[model samples]
Target: MQLPESQVAVLEAANADEATPVDALAAATDLPPETVTGAAFELEEQELVAVTERVDETISLTNEGRTYVEDGLPEVRLYEAALEASADADPAQMGQVIGTSGLEGDEVDIALSNYARKGYGSIDSGELTADPDADPAADPEATALESLVDEGTLEGSEDVLEQLERRGLAEVTESTVREVELTEQGVTELMAGVETAETVGQVTPELLTSGEWDEVEFAEYNVEADAETVEGGRVHVLREMSERVKDVLVGMGFEEMDGPHVDADFWINDCLFMPQDHPARTHWDRFALEQPTHIDDLPEDLVDAVERAHREGVGEDGEGYHSPWDEEFARALALRGHTTSLSTRYLSGEEIGEIEPPARFFSVEKAYRNDTLDATHLLEFYQIEGWVMAEDLSVRDLMGTFEEFYAQFGIEDIRFKPHYNPYTEPSFELFGTHPTTGELIEIGNSGIFREEMLEPLGVDCDVMAWGLALERLAMLTTGAEDIRDLHGTLADLEFLRNAEVTY
Candidate 1:
């Protein structure tokens, strides 16, 4: 390939100093580092002083190549047989979208029909094909990725994940999710920008005429089409629902409490009256962090209270689980599976001391469990945990709040099943009717705080804590069999951004 002016400059610079840095070469040449590097590479190929990052390919060509015979070669890469009677075409039918436009349409339909056999991102298309020559030593993407990395252009392990994400090619935990519910104001703006995706930026001559067309990616032009009027973007349905729940708590004059996705067993299990021996504590039932270490700074009283409850019930009966509480075990840190721990702190702390007679708190944080992943379960997920405490909170109040919160999510048919919990006196499990499945899907569990849990916190009144699975609600509302349907879609977001999902 003919070397560009930039490459010629890189050649001259490399010959001048075998000691200069890659950055210095770019800076001295007033060229971007990548361009400078590529130029330097071409110079080496043309027989200048040889240098390269690859160990096996150290130097460029030598002067001897200048005299090498130019072999006679065919100009064309390939040509079809003259008048070849149609490449896999019917003998007579030539008009109606046959071959790619027709055949591919059928293939695409089949791929979509059995989605269980494939993924939304996976399709029977040329773009989805694996690189024919993906070398262990030379993944082109990796080479670019590595070069960028070596240049300090890429930062974290997730940096590539982020880059791919920014261009709508990557997904991360913090990525903006278009929700299925939107405010009236959001819908107004969305309707305004509906055709925004269709309009492309004017292609500058510098780009189309740069002779760097080989380097330009075709995928960028393959932007998602907006010709067919469809949904736009917004937050995720789960997030939208979670926000509604948050709003409800705030409107109820309840303090919105927050906590870590990771928590201590003392807070997650013991403080909330979860028995260590309970099946939920087993690795099979819940995700236990690889290392069992406590957070650096934990409230001493919370630790002590949780410990006391574990050793002996923190109740009027003054009896614990009738077993010795393991302090070391309690101190072991864990991924927070529910938001109840947030309430544990609010109910029994000196910070709340004498500040109020009645209080309420809630959380909508991601939780982790160890169930096999399925439409019904995920190893890591989110939960809406909450609690209410007062001079006289009763079962009636519990049922009232349950009905109200579910109703907020457009769920009305709910059944309460008698249940048991280490931390509460009268425990219950809440099951909501699945909209599409018509199955009684358990959404959450709740109960009044048991003495072992509250007595240690020094709380004088009974408290109840409950949590709902946000994904379950999403599945019910969207009629999606897979939890992933709630994610990775502009439609999902548009639906949420325009959805009116509240009382």
Candidate 2:
């Protein structure tokens, strides 16, 4: 092959310096190392240079790489070995490396392998590892602790702790008993409110077309008339849903249940009858929090029943979950993606345990996912969750409550199709007709809690659970085509402000 100008330059440079490493070549040439390495590689491939070797058949060439010698066109050397050794490098790095390794011929490739191993780390299929021969390190528990501290989720740092002791949000921590507090700045931030004002003089007509106002601070320059702007003055839509869901429960004479969103994997998954080895427990499926609260006090009776269920399917010990359900794995912490968090929440209330005939509870909050953001998917979105606990609660009871509930929204023709949710037996995936679109939309899922799920919550009765995407509901009601259209707007917020909040 006829050598290109860049190629000839690299071949000449290679002969000038014989033993220098690729890294040094990158600097010496004043070029990105990848460029030099690249051209040099081309020269070697054409029988110009020779290469040498390492542990595996990794080697360099033997002759002057792409030799431009005594004759006009020169005796070109195509050193296959040298080119092969540096094959993984970017074109620029290859050119520089070949130039620096001043080997007279193709032997430069041997030097390139040495270049990568030392400066670039271990080469695996041409990729670099920080420390190749060693196993990658898993995150240390302390790293998670540090993250929680950074996020202001955890308390303790002796100096900070001591200062917090005396002050509240700004408390001076002198003792171990630091009050959990938020600063006035933090309070304003957490309560979600902010105010700003701006007034800017219009630029002269000449300035307008020239972008003269680009860097202007309109807020600081306002004249006589005062104007103000305020934002974040409301609870999140998800939070609003939670309140509405709670109202639905309270109106039915049910009290709220409280549980931390930071509970361990055991309560979130295992206690709820999820198998430890199930795919949902994997990192891809759920958002595992750095510092999670572990539910240590598993009600013994429920624990035994679940253990039996797992050891044997629904009934017999035969064909049941075989492996030992790991207790440690169960205690892992993660964000509560489902309002089923309400399950443990209700269990914590004595009234739930003492309730006579009928009891209902609900929760609404954001569920997370790894889905890509699009018209129909989001990493986070709102879920409206509700459930009722009672004896012999027929599927009819379940349909009746839904009747009253969906009626409030003016939606009709509610129907359920058989579905399987891991925690619910006789489950349902709800479908509703889009009032305007006339298209059938599957909105949510519901089912009476399976024996496996209820056993963990200490509930012996049939507990029915149902959930739907609040965002989807909003999208339908607001005539939105995209999922993102649902919120963070003045109109949407105003709608919530004015919407009927029926009990």
Candidate 3:
């Protein structure tokens, strides 16, 4: 019987008496494990070999876990220190115990959190007490870590291993281990004798030069064979979504706008008609720059115009906040809470000169806010900002624009509720039903720019604008329940890798 070189090599290495793993076969046959695996599957299909597959989990200690094995686990060390300080009978100051434990920075917190959970001790207020009966030496997680160090793997310690993994002290990976053994047919074939066939796996330069390619037999590929999955570099889901948004907005006849991430409150809020004393302008909601506290290059005329609008009002009938408006406060720099600063800059001819009437502009940019992190909120996020400077713009135009924009992403059921924004009159929040949860999520805010905002920017025409959450738009499209899952320290890599940006 004649077989491809790889198949013949695999057959010669595989044993009838014992199953040999693909790695062992690869070593014996001098072929890649994947090649051996593919050959084994082909032999199995031909009834020449039996291939058995099982998932094998590999356990290994991380750098931190190794350190714990050498210096003792943080919690264990803390307990020992507490006991030495007579904490078993009475509470000891946490700082003193931690200092004695030699734990610093994040390790101190790690020790404290796990100490209570593992029955090592109780941490009350600012004190720590060691449990006299607690045995740090017999700690399952510590024992598991030691076992991994000694034996290079673990068994019957799933719970402990999981705990260690959660603590970022250990790593566990699963791989499909395939073992091949000769079947009755394979044994018979070996007895009958098999020969290696000269089959070309790929076209070579020598073969082409010699004009022997036509005469050579090509090896048939096993397309069904399990191959290694390679997770090559890919554009992040958020970045991809941002680019897609740019494309959509560009298609909708809007030119992209660019500006500073850190800008003067003058353009960010003052130009938007937000009073200096507005709650949203406070340090609690906005990130203020410390070193270069104030912006030096604010346009003078625009600053005066905005200040007048803030203090005295925009038109004859327009009413100001009557609040104390200070140029010094307006010049204070902060990480932009929104990308409306770009709109203000552009409208006032401070950015790319004055954008004339009937012009459309948009920006997909980062905005920093000291927001309470939650399922729907993040500290910093991409805001899809846009504005239309045209004649007689209205709420209908803003609503229709949002409807068209979201519809492109397959979200047709957009609902709007009247909301308030200091910059825009008749402001409303945009909501879209989450595909997975079916709950209406606040996706964006939109309204026509109020006279107080526009007149200062030297814009005589009507303007409708919005600052949409790019992450929320992604959630609506990708069905991610938590905004953190999109991007952050707790980002779900598995979800991001598989998430498809619909539309």
Best by TM-score: 3
Of 2 and 3, the candidate ranking higher by TM-score = 3
Ranking by lDDT: 3, 1, 2
Model 2 per-residue lDDT tens digits across residues 110-224: 3333333233333343232222232112212222234333563333455443222211112222211111112243233323632332435356666677786786544222132
**RMSD each, Å:** 23.4, 27.7, 7.2
User: Which residue window of length 10 is worst by lDDT in model 3?
Assistant: 154-163
Task: Give one digit per residue, the lDDT tens place, for model 3 in 1-503.
Answer: 99998999999899999999999999998999889888988888899999998998888888888999999988899999999999999999988998888888657756765788799989777788889999887888888888888889774466777567656678878888889999999999999999989888899999999999989999888997877798877789999999999999999999999999989988888898988999898988899999899988877888888888888897789889999999999999999999999998899998888677889999999999886455787879999999998898878888888888887888899999999888888989989999888999999998988898888888999999999999999998998877877887656676778998766
TM-score of each: 0.51, 0.48, 0.72
In model 2, the runs with Cα more than 4 Å from the true position are: 1-249, 292-304, 314-319, 348-357, 488-503
**Tens digit of per-residue lDDT, candidate 1, span 1-503:** 22345644554455332345556777677877655555444444444434444222111111221111121000000001101223222221212212222223223332233222222122232122212222323322233334342463333355444323322222233211111122343234334542212222345677678865555433122122112335556566677777877887788777777666677777777777676777777766666677646556667867777767666654466666666667667767777766676677667663355425567777778877765444466666778778887777777789889888777667788899999776776889988777655778877888888766777777777676787788777666666555544553212343346544444
Task: Please report the candidate that would top lDDT against the real structure.
Answer: 3
After TM-score superposition, the amount by which residue 34's alpha carbon in candidate 3 deviates from its true location, in angstroms, is 1.9
Worst 10 residues of 2 by lDDT: 69-78
